[model samples]
Target: MWHAVKTLNAHNGYVCALIAKVARYSVSAALRKESVALVYKSHGDPMQVLKLQKLNLPALGDSEVLIKMLAAPINPADINMVQGTYAVLPELPAVGGNEGVGQVLEVGGHVTSFRPGDWVIPRDAGLGTWRKELVLKEHALLRVPSDIPLACAATLSVNPCTAIRMLSDFENLQPGNSVIQNAANSGVGQAVIQIAATKGIKTINVVRNRPNFQTLTEYLQSLGADYVITEESLRKPEMKDIFKNIPHPRLALNCVGGKSATEMLRHLQHGGTMVTYGGMAKQPVTAPVSSLIFKNVKLCGFWMTQWKRDHEHEMGELNEMISSLCSLIRQGKLKAPAYTEVPITDYKTALENAMKPFSSSKQILVM
Candidate 1:
């Protein structure tokens, strides 16, 4: 009986140890999340520097949320960031995306801003969006309406927001007013055309001469561009014919600086504003003396990142702009630019295609 009692005690102790070990493992597995991200340790050619690596996320904090990324587009700015040429460069050994949409898979106990299944987007640039999953503070994300298309939500924060602000803040444009913009086939340019159209405004889109110019023109026209002209067209005497139908543009949007901007500025209505948002040509904007002195063309620059930072605490206007854009998207008045969705595993292909010239399609990484 003594031997049997001793054996029973040993068995009980072993059972307790087994249960404790399983409990510890269960807690660990519950607390940790695994993710894969496109990480770059140094600035160089993106293809050479970017790597896919598994990431183990720390346990969620009280103000944190666990997100599963849905889609992220490879914008020119993103490419520039990876190349260390963009105005905003994240710290090295960082994930590679700046814009994307994700869905909440879980939220911390004290997190009030989001719950499971809520859709969210980075509140600003440089949140490292090229990943399968992540843990971010609630303040780092902004909730987006989930009913909209995934692709639209994935791309909402930067280009469209820039377009909306430039159109609304730069000029008090009324119906029948015309807006001229270069890089009209770009994502922001497309947004400008469509948003201007909804307000009964007209867009004179200028694109570089391409072999498929006619098709591109028709496509921009279909998106409500009233005029699609090549760089060469902006200089010819025939350009006067465009003004015969529509008044001279009072607001000029310049993404491509240098001669392209000078050409766009030449046609602006007297006292009109030319807001420079990008320097695609890598050249200084040269304003003709006559245009500056006589035309009173106001030349200014806009960086969306700065704008967001300025409005970080005062988000009422920002939220309104986002809501307004989403409403337009639901109504079909606005649409995402032409995009080719590539899986996250195929990021190399997406990155390669995005760097191609005259590639109209935006490369989107779908998780």
Candidate 2:
């Protein structure tokens, strides 16, 4: 009886090894013949260092999902990252995108929240969605609602989330309260304006004058911006007239540093708080001592990653905010911002365009 049991165990081991070989062959057969991805070979010059090349699709890991890229935005952070100026840097020869929307092609056995054909977007940085395909851990992707526009969904990760956190994290804001922000023509700025509008909160928006300040102000106002002023206007003698009727804002959001940041603070009320999220001007933000000492004003910084880490247990709150914003889009209460969609074949041109001064719209790359 002992001899017979030993022979049976050996036969089962042989059967398991054969099954593994067949499974490997099946996976190899299922992979795409060729998929293209943009690889960063160096840091200093992004255009020269990054190149698109054909490579085999990576095998999915136990907690991973393979997504077929649908759309991605060439955001300012993405440009800075490729140029090695951004705070976070990935390993050399890494892929080069931070946000994108895609459809799940397959999910590993351990992934439970998503299945094949579900629309999803990156929830974290460095998954590098600027490719024909991607394999990311399930935790790094967020499921997007089907009703959202593909273009809008593609751009959701950073800008919208930033706006939501900035608004919600501050002390409870009422309808009559106001918020001031510079770079108000930006995606985040626009999102803040719309979100504030939904909450019946007024916005004091500031923008640098391009050749077309008239058109820009009108556009911002149409999106429910209560007041839109150019940077030059902030320095003008009659600046007080603009704020004569508006209350001193309790919250300020500054993206451009240097003088622009100082000007944003000037609009805040006594004891108001300023949150600096970006320094597009590449200069340190300076606040006059009088404002801090006499006014008791507070200065704070906002990094979305930090907020995400601290509020890990509040994902439900974040999702609720996002869903409400999406509802606004569905009702046609929100307008999709202007953007140029570049196809994969024209990625070189897209990269060049993304590096230029901010457009009135965003630049999207469609895979």
Candidate 2 lDDT over 1-367, as tens digits, reads: 0000001122124311110000010125346445677777777776788788765665666787888889988888778777877765555556677777999999999999999999988765566767887666787677888688887888887787888788888746889898989999888899899989989988989998787888989999999999888887777766677567667889999999999989877778899989999989988889999999998778888977556656657778667866877887787666557788999768888888777775676778898
Candidates in order, TM-scores: namely: 0.91, 0.88
Clashing pairs in 1: none
Taking the tens digit of each residue's C-alpha lDDT, what string does model 1 give over 66-91? Answer: 89999999999889878977655655
Candidate 1 Cα lDDT to native: 0.85
Tell me the lDDT of model 2 at 51. 85
Model 1: number of backbone collisions? 0
Pairs of residues at least 3 apart in sequence or in different chains that clash in candidate 2: none
CA-lDDT, candidates in order: 0.85, 0.76
